[model samples]
Target chain A: MRLSKLIAFAAALLLWSGAARAQQVSVIKFPELQKRLSRQNDTTYVVNFWATWCAPCVKELPAFDQLSTTYAGKKVKVLLVSMDYASQLDKKVKPFVLRRELKSEVVLLNETDPNTYLEKVDPKWSGALPFTMIWNGKKSKRATFEREFTPAELTAEIKKFLL
Target chain B: MKKLLSFFPALLALVLLSNFVDGPAGYQVGDKVTDFKLKNVDGKTVSLADNKAAKGYIVVFTCNTCPYAKAYESRIIELHQKYAPQGYPVVAINPNDPAVAPGDSFADMKARAASKKYPFPYLQDETQQVARTYGATRTPHLYVVTRRGSDFVVSYIGAIDDNSEDAKQVKTRYVEQAMTDILAGKPAATSSTKAIGCTIKWKKA
Candidate 1:
C-alpha cells in the first residue's frame, strides 16, 4: 500500500512538471525574429502576430492551432508571436496560453515602440493585431494579411507554399 | 490541371475585390482636410467649422470596445482640457459599426462618455466614411490638423505617444510635441508614428 501511494505521487509529479514545462514562453527581440525569417532554409513559416487583449486575435488563434496540427509532418512551422507587453508575461500571456493548451510554438515579442519596428517586421503591416505572414526563404516569396483568417482561408494560403 | 485552373479565377476575383475594399489613402501629412459634420453624443451635430475660435484640431479615432482606446481615455481627456484653451480641441470619433461591435453602439458610447465625464465632443461615425477617408487603421489613431491660412492641413498622423500600454512610462509625447511645435510657428519634427491597436471592425460588404 505504501509503495503504491509513493508511485502515484511520483507519477503526478512527473505530469505536473511536464505540463508546467510546456507552458513556458520565450521572450525575444525583433532582430532574433528577423534572423529566423532571413534564414536560407527550405522550411515554410506561418507567423501570426497576436495579443491576449485583442478580441479578434484571441478568436482566431484556434485556426492557427489547427493548421499547426494538420501540417505536423510537413516542412511547415506555425509560430504565434504574442504582442502582449513583456510585463504581462507571467500575469496574462502564460495563463492564457496554458488555458488554451496551444499546440503551436508561442513567444512574446519584446520590442516596444511600434513606430521604429513596425515597418521592419513587414512593410505591409500597419501595426494591427491578428496579422499573419507566410514566407519561404528558398522560394523567396511571402504573403501578408493584415486581417483575421478563417480556418479554410488560412489552409489555402499555406497550401500554396507547400506546393 | 483542372483543380489548379479553378483556383486562378478565384484568385483574380479576390484581387479585384480587395481593390474595391481598400478604396483610397485619404489624407497625407500636408493635405488639406475637408470638414465633416458628425453627430455628437449629445444629439447635436458638430463640425470642425463650429470651433471658430480654435487654431486647429486634434482628431482621434477611438472606440469604447478596444483596450488600447480604454487605456488612453484619461490621457485623451487631459489633452482636451489642456489644449482647448491653446486653440486645439480634441474631437473623438467612434468609427466601429455597432452591428459588428455591439459595445461601440451609440447608447454604449453615451454611457461611456457620461461615466467618464469626457470634456470633449464624442461623436459617432455611423457610415465609417470619416475613418476610411482619414486612413485610420487602428483604435486610438490620431491626426494633428493645424490651421494653414484658411485650410486645415494635416501636420501629424499616427500614435498619441510611443507607449500605448502605460502613459507613465512614456518617453516621448508625440502629440504634445506636435502641438508645441505648431504653436511656436514651426512644423512638427516627427509628423508620423505607428502603434499597435485593435483593427477597426468595418461593416460587412
Candidate 2:
C-alpha cells in the first residue's frame, strides 16, 4: 500500500509539472507571428493588440471573450495579442488571461522593434495599439481605433471584414 | 492640348496624394534634423543648432500630462544625467497645444520641470511647427540624433525602454542600447519601438 501511494504521488507531481509548463505563455517572435498569420487554412484570424495598463483594452477584452465563444467550432479564430511588456507574461498577462477565462489563444509579442514588424503585420498599421486586424483567407484588413472600442463597435468591424 | 492639360492635373494630383500616403513629415533615421529655438522652463531660449557643437542630441517630445509620459519622466532624467556630459544632451520639447491639453501649457510645464527637478531643457514649442516638422504625434515620443559631420543624423527613434511602469521589468532598452552603440560609432541593433500613448493635442484646423 505504501509503494502504491508513493507511485500515485509521483504521477500527480508529473502531471502538475506538465500543466505548469504548458501554462507558461510563449512570447511570439516576429517570424512566428508572421507564420501564424499566413499558415491559417480556412479560419479567419482576428488579432487585437492590447496592454494591461490600457483601460480601454481592459474594458473591451470581455467582448473579445464573448466573440471567441460565439465563434466556437467555426473556422474563425480570435487571437488576443497583448503588446504588454514581455516581463508581464507571468506577473500580469497569464493571470489576466486566466481570470478572464480567455477562450482564444493569447500571445505577448516578443520582438523589440515595431518599425520592422508593424509594416510586416499590415502596411496600413501606424503602430497603434488597441489596433484590430482581421485576416480572411485572401487579404488582411486592419482598423486602428485611436481611442477605446466597444463590443458592438468591434463586432461591426469583424462583420465588415468577415464579409 | 486638352488631353495634355487633363493628364497634367491627374499626374499632379497623383503625386500630391502619394506624398500624403507616405509619411513626409516624420524624420527618418540618418536624416538631418533642423534645429529650432524654443523657450525653456527657465524662460531661456534653447536651440539644437546652437548646441550643434556636441556629438549628438536626444530630442524627446514629452508633456506634463499623459500617464505614459509621466512614467518615462524619471528615465528621461536619468538619460540626461548619464549621457549629457558624454556628448548626448537631451533636449525635451512640449508638443501638445495648450488649448487642447491645458496641463501641457507653459505654466504647467514649468511646474512639472520644477517638481521633477529636470536637469535638461524642457522647452515649449508654442507654434508647434517643430513638432510637425518631426512628426511628433504623441507625448513621450523620442528621437535621438547624432552629429555626422555638420549634419545631425537621427540615430534612434521610439520608446526609452520596454516597460513604462517598472524599469526593472524592461525586456528591451531601445534608447539606452541605441545610445551606447551610437556612442561607440556602431549601428543600433534595433532602431524603433511603438507603444500606445496619449496623442499630441494639435491645433484645430
DockQ of each: 0.64, 0.15
lDDT of 2 by residue, A90-117 (tens): 8899998878767666788875556557
Using TM-score as the measure, the top candidate is: 1
True contacts reproduced, candidate 2: 0.18
What lDDT tens digits, residue by residue, belong to model 1 across residues A22-130?
Answer: 5788999988988766665688888899999988889889999788579878878888999999999999999999999897778899976888788888876777788
Best by lDDT: 1
Q: Which stretches of candidate 1 lie over 4 Å from their true place?
A: A1-22, B1-23
What local lDDT score does residue A96 receive in model 1, on the 0 to 100 scale? Answer: 96
Per-candidate TM-score, first chain only? 0.84, 0.75
Off by over 4 Å in 2: A1-36, A39-46, A55-126, A139-163, B1-12, B21-25, B98-102, B148-151, B162-165, B169-172, B184-198, B201-205
lDDT of 1 at B111: 97
Among residues 3 or more apart in sequence or in different chains, the pairs in candidate 1 whose N, CA or C atoms overlap within 3 Å are: none
